[model samples]
Target: MECAGYIDGAFVKGEGARFDVLDPSDESVVAQVTGVSAAQADAAIGAARRAFDSGAWSGLTMKARAAAMTRFGEAMRKRADWLSACAVKEAGCPVSSTVMGAQVHAPLRMTDEIVDLFLRLPEQEANPLPMHERVNPHFAVQSLKRWSPLGVVSAISAYNVPFYTAFWKVVPALMAGDTVILRPNPLTPLSSMIFAEAAVEAGLPPGVMNVIVEPGLAGGLAMTTDPRVDMVSFTGSCAVGASVAAQAAPTLKRLVLELGGKSAQIYLPDAVGRAASAALSVCTSHAGQGCVLGTRVFVPQERKAEVLEGMAALLATVRIGPAGDPATQLGPVISAAQRDRCAHFTRAAVEAGGRVVCGGKRPEGLDQGFYWEPTVLDLPDNSNPAAQEEIFGPVVGVIGYRDLDHAVEMANDSRFGLSGWVHGADRVKALEVGLKIRSGAVNVNGAVMSSYASGGGIKMSGLGRERGIDGLREFQMVTTLTIGG
Candidate 1:
């Protein structure tokens, strides 16, 4: 299937530039997409600017906007199969994961809930003063104004989970009454453009939501630094996020970054079995391409052997194969380059005196795809580069800690603090440990993942949160007003 960019509510071809979208599973050209030029990116930004200024979207009642977004969500759900198939081909995700995307069940439900929250939010209310304690008759009551949209938002998402990440930025920006220009990752652009098509069909105004596919850094920079863009939301590596921050500095544009992570999982002796299962679930999910995976496992020194044994057993059960196979629990890395990178890291870990307890090489018999077996390493210490750096692949570093205090210290040693997990028999102890970990989100005893939880990292991980009420606030600006009797 051929896929094109969506701009100004219409499907359009690029300006004399294009790139092939390869199916990562087999490295075959699945679709051709236009690599939008700077001119096209400027045009997209212009379209979003005009849409925001025209007030066609911003002026609509909250209920009206909510209804429109709901319809768009439904339309996306209707075309879930096409979107999922494209995602599988481009992202090299397991078939089950692709099926989940195609259903649009999670995205739709989350977006719908966000819209409902927006509609139900209370309007700016006036703060009353004490009548008897008024110092002067001129004293007036002040109204606490809620946040309003920041106008046009430039959303640049990564390739790992295209649709989900795009929505993480786009939905919140829209809920805050902003129009958007989305520049999807070059590796996977079709799913985002498909989303734009659904928005147009669902009565989204022209220029309110535009998508452009650009193959390299040029397009991303153009969108981020565009004068017409009011805010920039980016999800990528720390290196790119730093560049984006520097570029947006001169313009002083609002920026939201969800960057890389070297998140850790702490397994107490009492919770070894459960923690081992959770670690496997995270390390194998999306082939460990997620920024929030528990890539670092910190266990007490006394239980190191037991933890490694449990983790190895779990890793052995992982099935790596083509994305569409029902039996496959894991799929190929996003590309050959990613596969090579993972291999390089594994080799480096071995040279650094780390032992590969479970997987250390590519799976057998499936040579066409960019596949790598899930890997777990027992590193000599927490200071090893493999344990500290963000590997962005299916590899986990296991480091033994002397005690609870040492485990917490080890987990907090990384510059990246995106997310962490704690396992303990006592809920209070788990929560206490979670509080000590410096991360955006902490999971205790394999609790449920909440979409409403505020998510983002500290230190080098990134800036700003993407979920919860705080996420909604990030896209908005506040105003205050006072009135006298």
Candidate 2:
């Protein structure tokens, strides 16, 4: 596939600069995408700004915006297969995983759901308390009000699940009556470009949505710090998130950051076997690239032995191979650099006295590609770097806890509070632990993750929320109107 940047409702060849998209399965160049110049970035942002100022989108009635978004959702569903294929090749994600991530099932559902939510916004309601009632009672009850859009949004998404993350930002922003400047991760830009094409085909205004493919901090900074951008929504590492925050502070641009995670999966003694098996499945899924993968597993000390055995056994069964393989459960890490990073984290864990129960080395026979076998480590304590840091590959750390209180303590020890999982035979006991755990969202007994409820994090996990009504509110500001009787 040949790919380029999308701007002003069209795909155009970028400046002479170009980069190769490597197939992580074979370490071969899968595609080449032209690097967008600063001028191109400026043009895209300017177009988005113009689109916002002209009110082609913002001027539309709420119903009209919802209708356009619904059409965009349908177009996405029509091209889901091509988008999934692009995601698989560009990001080295398993075809099965890519189908779930980029195949528009969730995106389409989310778009429709959000449109419904948008149409039901509180703005349309009449003031709840009548002026005559207020005058007679001599008491005033505040009326509920809704938020309005913050204008053009600059959405910077990561490479892990390019289209999924991009849609999380773009759908909500556009639905809220804002234009967008989208910058997808250079490693997986094609899927996002295809999404942009679908949006334009669905009748999005010419400059309302634009995409630029440039691989570096410069492009991101230009988008984030641009004065024309009314808001900046980003998903990536905490380090970069901090940088973006600092740059946006001066302008006070509304910012939403969905950053890193060191999520915990706690297993009670009763469910140790089941929890360990589930953790193994999640960690190996998508080569453990998901931000919410329960990389940190906390188990009762008494059951640690049995849990480790089950985890290792489960890890051994994961089928790692090329992304295109139908039977593959795990694929190579996104790139050579990512593979080495996972390796470094593994070696560091071993050096820190952690025990490697399974997969401490690269898989045999797969000499090429950025493949690393799914790894499970028994860490000495929660302080180990491998346990505290966000290793964006297939590495899981098992930490033994003395009891329920200790388990809760261990889970809340991290700076990150993204997501957590609790497993036990007693659902009530698990709920108690779940409430104590300081994370944005908690799963009890492998409950499904919802885009509306599953959000960003607290503390170092970055600010604001994504998904659901809360996610949509991040792109808006409140207004108040007081009338004289």
Candidate 3:
């Protein structure tokens, strides 16, 4: 199949070179994409700029925008199967693991919430400047806070869960009346292309939503540095995200970067027994390409041996095979480069006096694809490369902690503070432990993250939130209008 970039209201076959999209399951060509040139990228940004300035989309009433978003969402639902299938082939995600959850369903549900929040936003609200009043009591002044849409946005998404990341960035920005040009990673561009089709089906005005595909960084650099683009919402690695920030600095564009994470999973004394089984959450799903998966597991020093044993037993039952297999619990990594990167990290850990309890290499029967076994490394300390680096593969590094304090200390020691997990029988203690961890979101005892709450990281993990009211505000600008008396 052939895929083209979507610009303005139509799909265009660019003048740039063609690149092949490979299926990681067997390293076969699933589709070929025509890359967008720098000129085409600038055209996309110009289209969004025109749409925003002309009020073709941004001038609509909140109700009309919400209704259009509803239609767009329904259109996406119609293509869920196609999107899921494309993602499985391009990303090597298992059919049964992330297909229905992150790839298709979750984004739809999130859209509903974003629409509701967008409707609830007050166009203008009264605010009393109490500090100013106290300082100058001679003159009375009344203030009103106004919420308005930021102009054009350049939404760049990662390839791990392509459609979901695009939806998470695009939907909220659109709902807040910001026109967007979505740029998906070239390796997995098929699913994101659906957004353009859905935009047309939903009757959105031209240039309100655009999708661009390119194999190199030039298109992304154009989006980040273009003066017409008002904001940039990006999701990728820390190194690339930093580069993006630096590029956008000269333009002074509003930025929402959801970057890397070396998150930790802490097992309280009472919940040490469950530590082994929890490894499935990281290893089994999409081969741990998820940015927030707790790859560093902190367990009690005394129960280290037991945890490793249980982990080995549980992982042994995981079915690792082709991504299309319904019974596959774990799939291949994104590509050959990713598989080799995982191996390099594991080897570094071993060289630093660590031992591999299981799965430091490829599976026995899977030689055709870029498959890496679900690995677990028993590290000598938290300083090991396997424990500290974001491997972006199905590998977990187990580090022994002296106690709860030591565990919290070790968890906060990392520069990346994205997500954390705590397992404990006592709810109060678990909550306390979660509070102490210096991360954005913390889950206790298998509780899932709420869509209503904001999701983002602190420190190096990321700069801004991605969901709920706070996420909506990320796409909006706040102005305080004062009435002088």
Clash number by candidate, in order: 0, 0, 0
Superposed on all Cα atoms, model 3 deviates from the true structure by an RMSD in Å of 1.7
Model 3 TM-score is 0.97
lDDT of 2 by residue, 63-175 (tens): 99888988888888787788777767887778776435433467656778888887876753445776675455555545545467779899999888888889989988999
Instruction: Report the lDDT tens digits of candidate 1 across residue range 1-485.
Output: 24345778777777737788888788888787667777777788888899999999988877888888888778877877876786678887777763354224567568787887676666565456566533467664545565566789989998888888898888878877899888888888878876687777788988998888877777678777878888899999998899999999888989889999998899876776675675577665788888988889888777777878888888888878888777888888888888898888888888889998888788898889888888888888888878878888888888988887888999999999899989889888888888999998788876444457678888888899987778888887777765555
Model 2 regions more than 4 Å off:
1-3, 97-104, 124-146
| Runs of candidate 3 exceeding 4 Å displacement | 1-3, 131-140
CA error at residue 250 for candidate 2, angstroms: 0.9
Best by lDDT: 3
Question: What local distance difference test score does each model get?
Answer: 0.80, 0.82, 0.88
**What is the model-wide C-alpha lDDT for candidate 2?**
0.82
